[model samples]
Target: MTSRDAKTYEEAVEIVLRTLVKAERIKPTQYARRLVMKEMNPSREARSVSAGLLYSVLQKRGLLDEVIEDVLEITDDVTELDTWVRNAARIAVNEVVFEDGDPDEVADVLHGLVRRLANPGAAAIVKAFTLDLKDYEPPEPEDELDRLKWEYYHPRWLIERWMEMFGDPDEVVALLEANNRRPPLTIRVNTLKVDPEELAERLQRKYRVTVEPGRFLDEILKIPEGLPIGEMPEWEEGLFVIQDEAAALASAVLNPKPGEVVVDLCAAPGGKTTHMAQLMGGEGKIVAIDVDEVRMERLREIAERMGVLDCIETHLMDGREAPEKLGREFADAVLVDPPCSADGTIPKNPERRWRITPDELERLPKFQYELLKAGAEMVKPGGRLLYSTCSMFPEEDEEVVRRFLDEHPEFELLEVKVGDQGFDMPEACRLFPHRHETCGFFIALMGRTG
Candidate 1:
């Protein structure tokens, strides 16, 4: 019954700065929302402005840090500075240099902010930006990979890795350009509750936002200008759930049928699980397994909201334990969507490009291979097994699948056909942001023939 106080840009900065510092441990968007709820419930306009600023700052963080390092004339990395000072300088440079904000205005706001934070060290960086950041230009690298890294605001090692995989500079550049773009807001219509046509018409009429059919499935819809689904009544009514086209296609690739027993590994936040349930007309059993109890709880909540909970059974355990607990050769279809560096999600989670390291990339395929082996164990003879990931890396995709297939000769790769999208590899479907306008995804469908 009380009116919330208005939130300022400085408060937003405080939230974003703290988020950037903690983003390595947690998701930036989720952490920022938590901070927003705990600190201030701003108006829609204020929230939009803060969200835009945060996304811009995080998206170009690499280039912004470079600008800050240039402005400070320091040979060392800017990360060595105080947290408050470092983040403050990043925001200042991002706004004035990258976003083309008025330097005097940015300086005035940040100076007051630094004073409030009571960090004398931060004031120097803010002052430095006010003076030198106006006309600062980053030096172009002579090397091609280095040029792409600086120009696209990506890590150099990642660029090199992509170049090696793609083998063509133009294709790599296209992928990089695609990753840098803002991702579209796509939602899957919950057919259990309402049909896609009805839901699309309702959304277009009620919200007045542009809605179009998605590329992958008939039930999928795309909103060019994204709506705040959480606050929308249609979302609360569970007419739809937010999901990407490529993610939805993974379930279709598996093609779970009604009355079949399906197992979903690592199925937390249950997007594909629920989609499979819908495909089955909510008549099949989906054993959803995940290690994180909290995320499993969320999956249950989403499944319940989407009116597909009756078909989905949630289990809190590691996906690798699924075969031992559930018995081998039981499931009609098994979906193994294990963890990875998630480089494919860079378009939506720009912070991911910086967070992913070579070590993590090197270690993930073993885990993925193990999970795929477990999934194979659960599939009955002549049943289907689908291994999918939102990763563009060949090591995580083809190499893991190759290892699994070589070890388990009973499972044979099948051609993946989803709405006329052809696979270059002929056995697995790969979706790219530049070509398919979706997240970089790999879906390999296989059948057990023992």
Candidate 2:
């Protein structure tokens, strides 16, 4: 590539990295999208390259930092640099050592990018770091859990917990490997407007991208990655919504009926809420509740874009308050998609593997159980209550459900079979990235028994 072309790609990379460094614990892809739109609109190739690098740096951050520290030690530079320079070094190491890019080409582009930040000395550090990165071996932890965590690019505590849960270290490795890989781009067809086949044809014709029908649901479709599918005309016209297969299956398991009143606790960004609307033929009332104003606004926007806003009543309130505020035992069905560590989403949000802490893991299940109880209180006798989470932890999934069932004699576990993919509980269901090629998820359906 020409020097000008290379410089343009580096600029895109710099813009994305600048934003990414500050967006701690937030979805990096959303920030990347925001920056791409607001800042310089780079070419499609540049966006693709930058996005690949951004995810790579985020995913393998631990290893990259190790390499950078090793190089810094060798160069005898103890001075702490700015977060931007450190991030730049991480991106450079990811490109040169892991992605096997042309080292000299990466060095040249990185120098230009770092120069823009007015850190000429930082550029020297990065250049040396990149050159020596390949030869650096990440220090192996003596403990088995720590070694596995380092090897798999996950938290040591999480690796140990998974070992306890699965009782097999090899199985944990398989799951970790799946989480490290880039997940496919999956979207659900707004069947209330267009069928999957027609939407697939339209997407292919307009975007010139391959669209595969999802394995679990007919209304779901998977598009090739890095297509800027959100910018498509169909998206703006409310033809489909980007959703994962496992998430769609949760709504399917609930199977909301037409004219029924359904409650969607923890419903922000409206993936399951909109799916329920479609299943109900847009004929039912969906009471959606979330605590965050920003996320609730996002839910409204998505519901509007999917043409299901009219069927959804959004409330910016804690789901635990739904029982008192919205009344109890009124809704025909309730979906409790409470928050958790979201370990199952690691494949799509790689930074999550490192972001979740032991304390957070302990706290999430308690909150999840409360959300499930609130949803249960809103379900009428004989009504269905589907509890689900994008978490691989039993503490957040099976254990929470177990405790709820133990405490609430009025609720009985009902069967929730989704083809061959099933949870250990005969009545519940699960989807794993290694097995199901979808986000790791858990679903348990219960009936309010008077």
lDDT of 2 at 90: 77
Clashes of each: 0, 0
TM-score of every candidate: 0.89, 0.90
lDDT of 1 by residue, 1-450 (tens): 112322356556666666665654555474455554455554555555666677777778877887777777778998677776777788888878777777776676677677676565677667666757778766869798778887788999998988888798899899989988877678999988898999888888987888999886899999877776556788877888888898899998889999999999989989998999999999979999999887788789888888889999888988888888878999999999999888888888887788789998889999999999988898999999999998888888888888888888888889886532323457788888888899889999999996
Candidate 2 residues lying further than 4 Å off, grouped into runs, are 1-12, 25-28, 69-81, 100-105, 117-135, 140-151, 419-424
Give one digit per residue, the lDDT tens place, for model 2 in 128-240: 66666556555759888877777777777778888887798888899989988887789889988898999888878877888888998999898766357555688788888
After superposing candidate 1, which stretches have Cα over 4 Å from the reference?
A: 1-31, 34-39, 69-84, 113-136, 419-424
